[model samples]
Target: MLSKVITIAQQKGGTGKTTLAVHLALAFVKYHNLKVVIIDTDPQGSLGKWFMVRSKKNSLNKNLTFKTASLWGAQYESKTFKKDHDIIIIDTPPKIESDARPSIEAADLVLIPMTPSHVDFWATEAIIEIAKKAQKKVLVQINRANQRSKLINKTHEYINSIKVSATNIIIGNRQIYPSSMGEGKTAVEKQKKSKAVEEIKKLSEQILLELK
Candidate 1:
């Protein structure tokens, strides 16, 4: 079967795009026993580094396979590699560059991760417009939410008004995520009860359900 390709993108940087991509890829491999692959399309290559760390420590799971490639590489592979894997998650760059366009175009689903802030909200419009132009399924994931803040509700309303699908999952700010990445471990295994892990797992399940 052809793999479901999901591209995690945000024009604005530091929005947890790579983090979500890495964790979600691992989640699918661990929980569902699916052959998951991650394409590090980002120029920063944060996702590539995470995989490198896992490989060096011999902590990488046999079920999870990842490769680093540019956006052009993704397009080339999409045409040929879709049938070999169960899922391919692409970690896109944080700019509306020439490379990002093709990855977005090749995606079956485009997940835009952002925090609950005015700057992120404003930047989302451009990303959403690009995804819409590509005619892909676009969903917004609210990252780094604070339970006591009203920004989450406001951002949800704003995105809904703009007719974007906002996920019911809200990943809160947690130190365990960064810490787990530093140790080359998935957040779900590092901080089992943290809100971050719960939210990401829910989001992953939702994505799987949607794909089915």
Candidate 2:
């Protein structure tokens, strides 16, 4: 089994950090048949709330596990989870700055999600530097994006200048993402064939390859 810890982090709020965490967790389970555990380090408890909804709906999957921990505590918890789970995803609160180090250090890869905007690009640097300083591999995820927008090219240029790898598969700005979460299901589970599902599957495949 491939045991890896991925920390989804962003210094700015509303970057879809929690959303990415749950989707990736479910995608790994549903599509890759991997044992996945998601640790909610965000005090807002969005991930925990989503899990609660899933449990109430009796829709919980055996391959998926949910836990709560502080960002600092995630490092220790992930080590313990690594023994049994194929992947441990740490969902962190935004604006954590230096406090994000422990989680970053725990991860084999730090997955930073950002929108294709100058504001998001500016906010991404701190987390990226923290991850790079820890000598951990980093993958930047462009989330909730409009692929046709002119800003898309500018986003690529910024990423290139920073010399960090960004995913080829960009997660589009879709209502299905938030709507599916409301039902405690991912887009992949809520719909069999859709653009959202396609993006997630391709992303999971790419991430799994990077982990190997």
Candidate 3:
């Protein structure tokens, strides 16, 4: 079988879409020892920056390599990606433009990350509609959740009422995420055994199971 392509997308920014993509890619490489390639499709190139820093520091293992590719290059990259790689994770821009459409269309699964807010939820719906139209498997990751907040609980309930499969893994708001990313390190590597790493790991496992 061909490699599984996973696209991380969200119409609204600051939802940790790129963070999830990078950590998940690292998790697959670190834990499963899978040959993984990350396609930095976002114009911001957050994933690319992370890869560069990690490469400079020799933080990543030999099993993984993150490559930078334009949104327009997604089809070509996917076509030419090595069969030896276990998975290809694509980080898309924060809009539903023509460029972003191709990444979503080419993906085996589309993951939409959002916070527990009405605006974020609405934006997620728009993305989900597009994914549904493209006939792609769509999943939502609730990022930066506050367990004690009523809004978070309500948002979770609302998401469950929807037809899409919302991931049970909830990534809480943590200082480590912003602090470590500033140094070009992933939360998992910077704060090992922290809650943030554990949550991201669970999310990664759920994604792998779905792909399986």
Model 1 over residues 3-53: C-alpha lDDT tens digits?
Answer: 888888888899989889888987787777788878887777777788788
Q: Which stretches of candidate 3 lie over 4 Å from their true place?
A: none
Model 2 bad stretches (over 4 Å): none
Work out the TM-score per prediction: 0.94, 0.99, 0.91
Error of 3 at 126 (Å): 2.1
lDDT (Cα, tens digit) per residue for candidate 3, span 1-212:
33889988888887888888877887787767788888887778777776677678767467676777887787568756746678888888786654577788778899988898998887777778778889999898888888777887878777777788788888898888777766667787777698988888887788888988
Candidates ranked, most accurate by TM-score first: 2, 1, 3
In the range 1-212, model 2's lDDT, one tens digit per residue, is 67899999999999999989999999999989999999999999999999999999999688999999998999999999999899999999999999999999999999999899999999999999999999999999999899899888898899999999998999999999999999988898899999999999999999999999
Which sections of candidate 1 miss by over 4 Å?
A: none
Error of 2 at 109 (Å): 0.6
What is the overall TM-score of model 3 with all chains considered together?
0.91
lDDT of 1 at 124: 77
Pairs with backbone N, CA or C atoms under 3 Å apart (clashes), candidate 3: none
For all candidates in order, the CA lDDT equals: 0.83, 0.94, 0.80
TM-score for candidate 1: 0.94
Report RMSD (Å) for each prediction in the order shown. 1.5, 0.7, 1.8
